[model samples]
Target: MLTLPGYLVHIRKRGGYRKRFGTRFGRGMDIPVKRAGARRIWIQAVSLGEMLAIEPLLKALASDERIEIYLTVTTSTGYALALEKYSELAVGISYFPIDFYPFSSRVWDRIEPDIAICAETELWPEHTHQAVKRGIPFLLVNGRLSDRSFKRAMKLRGFFRTVLLNTAQVYACSELDRDRYVALGAPSERVVTTGNIKVDVAIEPVLDPVTCSSMRAEMGISDGFLLLGSSTWPGEEEMLIDAFRAVREHDDRARLMIVPRHAERRHEIEAMLRERASDLAFHFKSRGLPERELDILIADTHGELRALTQLADLAFIGKSLPPHTEGQTPVECGVLGKAMVFGSGMSNFRSIREGLLQYGAAREVSDEAEAIATILDLSQDPAKRGKMGEGGKAWHASCKGAVERTVKGVLSWLDR
Candidate 1:
């Protein structure tokens, strides 16, 4: 079954499959066995975003000489990022085993973790069962239960509650999340509201002034107003393009830089742009310097959004624009103090959105027309833009210390 075309393609593309699969059968392969008297910690994050959220915790844990860390990720991108970012700190990085009784038991035996931490919403019943049966502590850190997810979980409350009860504790991201988790079968006493770790994201801009200026020049926007559409999703790109067109109708010097959430969709996005409006000249960041006459810069590359956000005069976070999707994190824009706009579907980051609104840090638009109007208004009024930017910086600063609080909470559990 693993040799089928689609499965084979996935495994080959991800690489190191044999070694990773070996770990599922209690074989460590090249991974060093844990020291006899050392504490072993297994941390699992489901994807890139979850991995990013757990960075502060990882760094803190790495500093402790008595602890050994083993990190696992479910997705190919996440596994790649783990190796790139944490190879030195971690004992080993591997793909998470399939969450079946046999596979989970094999991995449990191999790692023999003193504790297991799952970032965000990555809950596997078999894994939890194995941990519970082995008497190893299992914790769900930075946990959240969105309304949509809560509704679905409620339908299987009996089973889900049993699985959740196996966890030693659940550190929820918000009070609402705590309540929802309780309603869905987690013991109220075992859950605590630790706030969202994402709010404490480290925002060190990768580009300095010289490099930023060079990048701007290369993208044909050294002197113009740059509006970044950061981490935009599929349908959100079209809405942004339309908004950019409207903005350019009045200010031709304005430029739109879109960094799509998925870089692999660059070709699809390019095709869509051509189909929607072929007259709009755009260049892909991966292809080299853009033409001097180009109006749009498609940052179709990975790990560049942070630097790009720093360059923008204003930004619009994606995923929110489409009614069905719950929006990407705007915390990066907030942290950078950028004047920003986002669509109505921001339930995933509801607390962050509300905080930004209370401080006048961001504007929420219900549709494309509203987004265009707000973007144009921000572009024209320097004073308004400056105020929004400052407000965002203040809001983001106020939201710090979640990481410290979360680390403290995790340590309490580990100590016990």
Candidate 2:
């Protein structure tokens, strides 16, 4: 089969092959010794987004004296973030074992968690089988089946149903997600809509006016409206650059900021920016604050999206443009109360997208031209942008409490 080649491609794409090779293949893991009388929990978050989503849940679980947590992440970036954010909270943090025979089994034997939680769609067969054989309650938290994934699951309905059968509960993010999980053979009685926990995670503290002004000054902006490209993917940087060019033609006060999804793509983005907008002065955040006034700021860094979003006047959700299908999370923009836009490729967050649209919190553009025009219009009308921002903030508030409900469900299962 293509498993080895697929894993090789996966490992190579993220770089750091040698360091990740042993642990990923189930050779060595730093699982901590279990504390006497303490129930150990193993939580797997696939990447940065999933790791961020589980922050509130981790805090809630940590508050209980009887429980200990071991967290695992797949990507190098996620592992780094785990170390940075959860070093004190979690007992151990390591790379997730590759899902196969001895690999998944070895890690499972080491952790021997009383309970296991998998975020989003990480339903690894070998991993699930290990927990099932051990009689551990396997839970699917903040679960969703995106449009693309739903289609694929439908094609492999039988196999997927087998996996679903192994899960003790499916804590779905929306009624639609609950229905989708049931349709895919998750027992209807075991699946429940628990709202979106991303809404429950803490938002960045609001900056004071003086601090905001100083940060703006540091970025070389003196009264310009910022157009932000949040978590952009391939082909999106070029589209945003072209759109920024168009916006600058109408309003010279308009500036641009791009925080690409993968910081490793910095050189590619830098080359595109230089070629497309030679007249514009841009600075990379990795190089520290700009020494002079600049027209653009390229944020090629990690774990700073919410902080950067606080400075934007308008935001465009990335990976929604042409040649790309799934869209990035708009939760940060919604929570930060920023006026935003996205294309038609948001099937991944279909439930959240619909909620944002219904609340008048966002704009859906058909193409780059529409996105440019909308940005210009919103930039010119501060009152309209303000209303959309307030609407987004309110919508985010309405979706809170998922983390509380999830904690209750998880702990109840652990007790039983």
Which candidate comes out best when scored by TM-score?
2
Q: What is the C-alpha RMSD of each candidate to the true structure, in Å?
A: 3.0, 1.5
Candidate-wise lDDT, in order: 0.83, 0.88
Give Cα distance to truth, residue 168, candidate 1, Å: 0.7
Query: Which residue pairs clash within candidate 1?
Result: none
Give the Å shift of residue 219 in candidate 2. 3.3
lDDT of 1 by residue, 1-416 (tens): 23336755676664546546665344553456889888888999987778777888898888888789999887766777788889998998887876766767878877889889999887888889998999988999999876677788899999888989998899988898899888888889999888888888886655677888887887777767888898888888888888788778888888889998877788899899899868877889899886575788899876667778988999998888856457788888888888999998887888889999998989999888889889888888879988998998899888888778877876776788
User: Each model's TM-score?
Assistant: 0.92, 0.96
- Best-performing candidate as measured by lDDT: 2
In model 2, pairs of residues that clash are none
